[model samples]
Target chain A: MNDVYIVSAGMTKFRKHNYDEDFRLMVKRAFDYALNDADITHKDMDGSVSAYFSDHIQGQLIAGAMTNDYIGLATKPSKRIEGGGATGGLAFQAGYEEIASGNMETCAVYGFESMSHLNTWKGNDVIALGSDSNFDYPLGGFYTAYYALMATRHMHEFGTTPEQMAMVSVKNHGNAMHNPFAQSPMKITVDDVLKSPMVATPLTMLDISLMSDGAACVILASEERAKSLCKNPVKIRAIGSSSDTMRLSDRPFGKVPLLPNESKDDYKNLKYPGVHSFRAGRIAAKMAYERANINDPLKEIDFAELYDSYTSAEIQAYEDLGFCKYGEGGKFIEKGYSEINNKLPVNPEGGLIASGHAIGATGIMQAVYAFWQLQHSVKKHLKNGKLQVENAKRGVIHSHAGTGAYETVSILER
Target chain B: MKNDVKGTEIYKTDPLIKRWDYSLSYTHSYAQDSEFFKALGRNVLLGSYCKQCNYKYGTYRKYCMYCGSETADIELPLKGKIHTFTTCYYSGEPFMNDVPYTLILVEFEGIDSLFMSRLINKNNTKISIGMGVMAKFKSLQKFDVNDVYFIPEL
Candidate 1:
């Protein structure tokens, strides 16, 4: 097996696009920008992968083929990948595998979502289709309601308060103030988030991510190729992917999947991975940590780009990633453990909450920001150094989909 | 030919975006779980029990998710407690007008899994976890999951 390195990455400003900006235009912009960032052109790429969550939102089927042709990679080896919100992260992993397997020397992964075309409510219906359509959707299983259920359960199981969840929105939205590519950056307070219009009980409109229209692209190359073609390339240290039952009800309780930093006794008598926690996230993070030889995440991993589709999910991730013990995530945040200036700055690029979640583009957007961070080029890509973690050497990018069905974690190092 | 093609609906004037409405219903089949929906019309909530693993599901399953064995249909208790729940102030197109509705995951007696259903008559009722609720079937059956809902136990 060969080593994979991210030579360059690019992301569009995540927001509601105007009438003229379709997905093709978004992909072209990110693709071209990525190539230019690496000081290379499309001619240097060997293959590609395209990602988008729904053909319904794009208003076109087989949209990946159109994007491949539009980006002038018409004859190159390319395919589309979709796993709901994990589409972009899956694409990034696919591109990494393409080079790691020696099937291609260089690969470009591009993802886009044009969700602005639909009304917000309608767009949510399309996303909710990712759930068990037969069982949940008919029972008014709106996505926010599903997260709300989990939030309520988290609160019951762990004494997690709505205020703790609100603090995550406050932190991520606050960080976005310095990130130009982020959509909704604000100096929000916990009170502001708590007072926002309730979409579901315990989750206000402010606690959720926006349905955005944007694109992101990352170019992965073999170590040999990256050393020659780029000034600074970040190593793809390890990638881990895992899944759980599609229906949340189908997930059975079991022993918590332990990371190197934890012990079985830590969660004794604890009903683990209930709706309050994500077992898939724990397994994925554990796999990545083992492969990357990371013993203690809180001490080793410099930062994290967590999938914060909802504020409560970020607190859930802190435990799943072993940054803190389960049921202590709320306290972890209250102590400012995840703040940008504190231990293990999370979502320095503002995460899905404040950065914008364009579904397929979201996971790759995390990668784009992580690549810039590891290269010590946040000032170069973001044009503002306010959100950059100091002396960052390693980071984790996580992407999640469904209620808890799919999770992908990839470690990146300088 | 040009005159014939000029009948497209204009969605927006500036960018020449055309209005293309994609509203259609799909005939979705429940396939193996057809019994569950049919049983709801009889006011029976059907779940699956794995004889091999001795695990029972609160929701219908053709196969045991844990042991991968064929599951036999089991009649689930209609009365259950709210394991967890959320009240929606917003929803999808189908349930959009039904905003402020409460959805719950109910835990049945002797069942290992939970079932999702709407909790009705929650207008003035304070819903909380461990609250006892009973299933109420629709008088007019839709043959969908919507046919059954829960109300606060009398």
Candidate 2:
């Protein structure tokens, strides 16, 4: 396989673009920055993959072909890929695979979403299409509604609180204040987060992610091609993807997936509180670290961008990513760990919780932030003033599609 | 838990026993101004089909999403099954009906046959997830496209 390196990445500041910003318009803006950043043009853009997991929400299925028309490369091959919230991340995976398999020397991956026009309450009803429609949808359940159940269950099982979840919002938004692109740029307090209206009981309005609209683009090129055009090339040390049951009910509750051990049967309680999220994220993390030849993530990776469509997701990632031990997540945030200037900084880009989320645009948005941070070409919102992953060298990007149903964790090295 | 439980039924009897339902919004599109709007005015359920993928889908689009082919316009079924369902007791026509009402995901039977619509139940029966449901037309005189609801199979 050829060495796939991310030469350039660009993202729109996540906000409620409504229908005011069309998917094509957003993708074009991000694409301009990406290509220029890569020292390439539309003609040299060997191939392209467009992803926007929301034709139902606010698109007319005009994403794939219309892009090349704008670039005047109307004849170049292009296609659309969808895999839930990880649509953006999945686009990157496609571009990377294309480059690695010698199918293309360089390719552009882009994702766009316009979520403001959507009825946010309907999110539960719609994402259910990818799920077991009969079993899951009929129960009056949804992604956030189900996630709320996870939060409540986690709180019941391990004493996790709405306040600890708030602390995460407090920290990430503070990080986003340094990031000019973050939609929810206001620095908030735990009190502010807790006081916010409850969208899903345990998940207050602040704990839930914003209905953001934005687009992101990343240029993936072979190692040889990137070194020639780019000042700093980020290597894809690891590219791993895995999935779990789309039916949330099918997953054993209260059970977490453990590392494959000598005694696989030694660990029997798979139905623990935070198992699915950890299993999805850890399996991705382990595959990434294995390729990077690093065992420890907290110390080895400089800056990390984990998918946090909700506050609970980040806490799950901390344990799943081995940033902390299982059942230590609440304490993880309680002690100021995982915040900027701590042992490890997560979501300096404000994450989905504050940055606003356009399902397909979210995961790629995470990767773009990690890319900018690693190159010291960091955006303003995530610079965190005190310690912003100082001259970060290696970074990890994770995008979880529809809870833990689909996961992609990639390691990027400068 | 007790206050949340113990459900009650609601009935409405008024001078106007039957009334027409309506839903409409205006968006400017030259392409839609011609044939599409004409269909919408006639209450024709419009959809699109892709020749390349040999798949049919609803909620019309300009391009074929699965195969990236230019699409041909088509129509969807008026009836379907309850793909999933929900009961809402907190809100909706409080004075006429309350306690609980079911909203179902109805899957139509046709070529790549699919669709989801709300179900209006007057029986107060148990609304299961995978229950068979069929469209209940309110007659063109009293009907509106958005107001079309499904009834239980039996």
Candidate 3:
């Protein structure tokens, strides 16, 4: 199989657009930027894929066909992929495979979500469709409630405080000040996070990611094609995806059964053992690491772009991805390890928190940010003396959706 | 070119309005889900057990996820413990009227899977993990998933 490489990456500013600006125009602009960045024309592309999460909000279906047509690539082989928030990751994976299998020398992959067209509640309803309709939707369980359940349980079992969760928002918001493409770039403090309106118990409004309108694109090529067309191509080292039970209730918490003759020690030790476990993420990370030949993620991985849909989710990712031991995520962030200049910088582009979540575009946007960081192209975008990792060789981008049910982990190396 | 028409001659009309009313219905059926709902009407919780792999699912499943063998149905006790819970301060339209309500995930003693329900008397009682609770079924003219809830165990 041929190796896959990302030759170019581009994204639109992640924020609300004018009422007249639609997804087609957004994607066209992003595609143009990517082609220009790669120093290649559309003639080099053999196929394309579009990631669109929900058509309900757009009031249209067959978004992939629309995008491909608008970009004048309708004759080429094209398709659409969706996995809620992991849509971009899945689309990227598909494009990579197309090149790796030698079926196409180069492919264009893009993700976009035009969510600002709908009202807040309507958009929320569309997003809540990610949950199980029979069980979760009937009971009014949306993303906030589902994540809040995990946060509350984590606090009860691991002594993780709401303040620590607030720190995640503070750090990401601070980092956004340097990111020109961020949606809401405000220097917020932990106190601001605490004082923010509560969306769910133990989860303030700042703890959640924003629903924004944006588009992102990346051009993937075979090793031979990349060598001939572009310099500083980032190799796609490994990619893995994993899924769990659809309903949150079906997720395993690893609760030990209270056997009639079992010792008290066993009961005490087993109580709430997996309350904070992100089973899908752990599975995906393990698979990706093995394929990428990375055993020590915290040491080997120079930077990371985690899906911080919620502050608690990011804390859980630290443990799930084996960056630290279980229940040590809160303390790990407290030590300033995940800061921009720290040993392992995470979300130096501000992550989904301040960067804004454009659903389908988020995962690909993470990859785009990672590409810039690894290539040291992020220097021009930074302001206020923000530090970038020197000699950055490798990075990981993780994305998940459906209440932690679906997870994708990709490893990229310079 | 000189304008010949005055401002009063121009017609001011209301914006065009289009009422688009659409409804979608889905019919989903699985062996385990059918059995589970049937048992719900009788106020009994049904779970699936795989004799081949010794794997048990608290929610009904037609086939074992591990062994792929058809599982047998078993009735689970109503008593369980709160595994986790959260109170919603904001929610979607369907749940807007019931804001500030507590939703709980209950774990039965012998089952591995969990059951999600709302606490009926959340205002009068404080909620916490590991607290004992029991399932309470509503006497409804029509049976639905919302008919079941949880209350603090006596």
Give the docking tier of candidate 1: medium
Q: Which regions of candidate 2 are displaced past 4 Å?
A: A18-20, A253-278, A379-387, B1-154
Q: Which candidate should be chosen as best, given DockQ against the real structure?
A: 1
Which lDDT tens digits does candidate 3 get at residues B50-137? 9997767776677887778999998988999988888888887667888887888888988878878787774734888899999877
Q: Which digits, one per residue and each the tens of the lDDT, describe model 3 over residues A338-369? A: 88878788888789999888888898899888
The digit string of per-residue lDDT tens for model 2 on A209-237 reads 78778988888889888888688878888
Candidate 2 — what's its lDDT?
0.68
DockQ of 3: 0.44
* lDDT, residue B118, model 2: 52
Best by lDDT: 1
Every candidate's DockQ is 0.71, 0.03, 0.44
How high is each candidate's TM-score? 0.97, 0.71, 0.91
Q: Give the per-residue Cα lDDT of candidate 3 at A162.
A: 89
Point out where model 3 deviates above 4 Å: A253-275, A381-387, B1-32
